[model samples]
Target chain A: MSISCDWPQAIIGVLLSQNVDLVAHVPDAGHAALIRLAEGHDQIDVVTLTSEEEGVGLLCGAWAGGRNGVLLMQSSGVGNCINALALPEICRIPFLTIVSMRGEWEEFVPWQIPMGLATPKVFEAMHVEVFRATEEQHVAETVDAAGDFAFTTRRSAAVLLSQQMLGAKQFKEG
Target chain B: MLERRTLVDRLLRHRPDNALTVSSLGSPTWDIASTGDNPLHFGFIGAMGQAAPFALGLAMAEPNKRVVLFAGDGELLMSLGILATIANKAPANLAIVSLDNESYGETGGQSTATAGPTDLEAVAKACGFSQTCTATSEEALDAVCDQVWTAKGPAFINLKIVCGPSPLVFPHSFDGATAMNRFRDAINKLGQTQGSYGRSNESEI
Candidate 1:
C-alpha cells in the first residue's frame, strides 16, 4: 500500500513528543514512507538493522545512553522481537514502537496472518502494551500516548498502524 | 548446592534503592518478595537473551546506582551477543548474575545452551569481564557477593542454583497493564531522587 504524505508529519510529531533520538527499523513496504521520514530527519539517528531482534538490542543500548528511542517494523517483525522485548521488560527501559500491521487489514500475503494474530497475544504474553492506529489523525496521538505510557511506566509499549492508513500509491504505465 | 532461597535472601539484603533487577520468567520468586522499595525490573518480556543489555542500559543511565540482571542460562544463551557489547562498553555499575540451572526452567525444564560444560565462567572471561566466577554453594555465593556488588566494569557471576517455578503469578497472561501501575510508581519514585533519565529534546528525523 502507498503510505500517506501526512503520515510523515504525524510521525514527526510523535517523535517530537516522545523525545525519540534513535530509531531502529527493518525495512517494510508499508513503512517506507515512515522510513523516509525518519531518514530525512537530522535529529533522529536512524539505524537500519539486519533483523527485528537487532533493532531491539540497538534500542536497548540507545535507551541506556539516556536517549529515547523506538523500533519500527512490520507485524512479522514483532514475532522476531519476542525474546528481544524481554530485555526492555526485565531492565525497565521503556521505549515506544510503531508496528506496520498486516494479516488483519486486507493483507496480500498469507505469512503475515500468523504474526498479525500473534502480535497482540505475543505482546500480552511478554508484558508489553499494544495499541492499534486506524487513521492518520490517530497516529500522532496514539504514538505520543504510547510513549508517555512507556516513559512514565518504564516499560515497552507499541502502536500498530493498519495498512489502510498507509494509503494506496499511484502508478503510471506507458 | 546453593538453595535458590539463600541467593534471594542475599540479593534482597544487598539490593540498593532504585536498583534494577532483571529476572527470567520463572527462576526465583523469593528474590521478588524481597524486592521491597527498590525498583524491580522483570525481564519476562521478549528476548530471553537480552537481559544483560537492558541492565547495561539502566546501569549506564544511573551510573551511581547498581543494576542487577537476574538471568537464566537459557535466556543468556539466546542473546550472547550482549556480552560482547557489554565488554566493549564496560559499565562499572552493572552486575549480571545468571542463575545457572542448566535448563530453560520456564518452558518445563528443558535443556539449554549451558546444559553441557559450556563453562559460563569461561564465556564471561572471553567476553572481557575481569571478574567472573561460579557459585555452587551458599558460602561461595556469599563470598562472591561483595565482589559482584562492588566490582567495577561489567561483572558476570554464575549462580549454580536449583530451578523452580516463579512465585508471582499474573491473574491473566503477563502484559503491560499487569505491573504497569506498580512499576510506574516505583520508577517515578526513583526519578524523583535520580533526576529525569529521559531525554528532553526529540530526534528530528
Candidate 2:
C-alpha cells in the first residue's frame, strides 16, 4: 500500500519512533534532509563521521553501551564500510544503515555507478539484509521495516533510498 | 624510550573495574589482554582505527562510567579524522591513549609517519581536544594516566615507546558473539545490582 508523504520526513518519523539514540553519518545528497532532522532531534546524539567505516564501529559501541544507533551514508560510502561491516555480523550486534542511492537512474556521476550497482550485493555479502524504497510512498514503511528487522532480530539491515526518490544530483556549471 | 607493554599496564593500572576499554586490532590488543581479561575490555580482532570511535559511543551510552581506548600509532593514523569527530562530540568520560612506538610493530618494525614527524597529540590539539599531551617518560605517563581516567575528557595522550614484539594473549573466546554477549551480560548485571541500569533491559539478553 502506498502512502503519500515527504520521504525524509516519513523516514525521520520512523527513526524517532524507533527511539534511535545515536545517528552517525558521512552525509550524502539523499540523506541531507534526514541528517538535519536527526541533528535537531532532542533525544538523538548526531555524530558526523569522516569515513563510513567508523560508523560501523560507533554503532557497535552504542550497542555495547546498551543503546541503538543508525548509520546514514551514500552508495559509494558503502564500499568504504565493507570491511568494518564484519563487526556487526560477527558480534551479532543489531545495526541499521540508511543508504541513499546513486548511479542507478538519471545518474550524473560515472564514478558512483560502480558502487551503486554493487551496493546491494556488497551488503548481502556482508550478511546485511537489504530493503529498497524506490518510491516515496514506500519510504516510511520501508524504514520502519528495516529498523525492526535489524533490532528485533539482532542482525544487520540496510534501507536503500532509491535515486529516483532522491532525484539525481545535477552538475552545476561554474 | 618507554617499554610498550609496561606503559600499557601502567595506564590501565588502578582503573575502575566498571570502566569500559576498547583495544585496536594490533599489539595494543595483545598488551591490554596481557594485563587481564575483564568483560569490560573489548579486544577488536580486525577493525582497525576504530578504537576511539568505539569508546566514544560507549562513553555516551554509559555516561557515568569512564571509557578508555588503546590504539597503535599506525591504527590512529589510519583514522586520524576520528580525533575531530571525538572532539566535536566531546564526551566527558572518554580517554584515548595512542601507543606511539614509532613503527608498525605488528607488521614488522617498519617506521610509521610518527617516526618521521607526525605528532598525533598536536593533531588532537588542533582538533579541539583540551587535554592533549605527549608523554615521553615513565613519570610523565604516570601523571598523564591519572588525568586520562579521571579528568573531563575527550582527552588524548600519545605515549612514545620502543618498538618490539609483545607476547600475544588472546581473549579466551575469539568468537565475537561470545565475547560481546558476555560483555553485555556483565553490564546488565551491574545495572541490576548497582542501581545504575545500563541501556539494556534485564530480560533482553
Best by lDDT: 2
lDDT of each: 0.69, 0.84
Instruction: List residue ranges in candidate 1 displaced over 4 A.
Output: A1-17, A22-51, A54-67, A72-78, A82-95, A98-174, B34-50, B106-108, B163-178, B191-195, B198-205
| CAPRI quality band, candidate 1 | incorrect
DockQ of 2: 0.57
Total clashes for model 1: 13
Worst 10 residues of 2 chain A by lDDT: A1-10
Instruction: Estimate TM-scores for all models.
Output: 0.61, 0.94
lDDT of 2 by residue, B1-205 (tens): 7898888887788788778888888788888888887887888888777677778777778888888888889999988888899899898889998889888887779999998878999999999997988888887877897667988998998888888777888775888899888887777666632212444321364
lDDT of 2 by residue, A1-174 (tens): 455567787877787777676899998878998889878878778999988988988888878878888999999999998888888888888889999999899997898889999999999999999999988988889989998888877899999989987889987899
Residue A39 CA displacement from its true place in model 1, Å: 12
Native-structure RMSD, model 2: 2.3
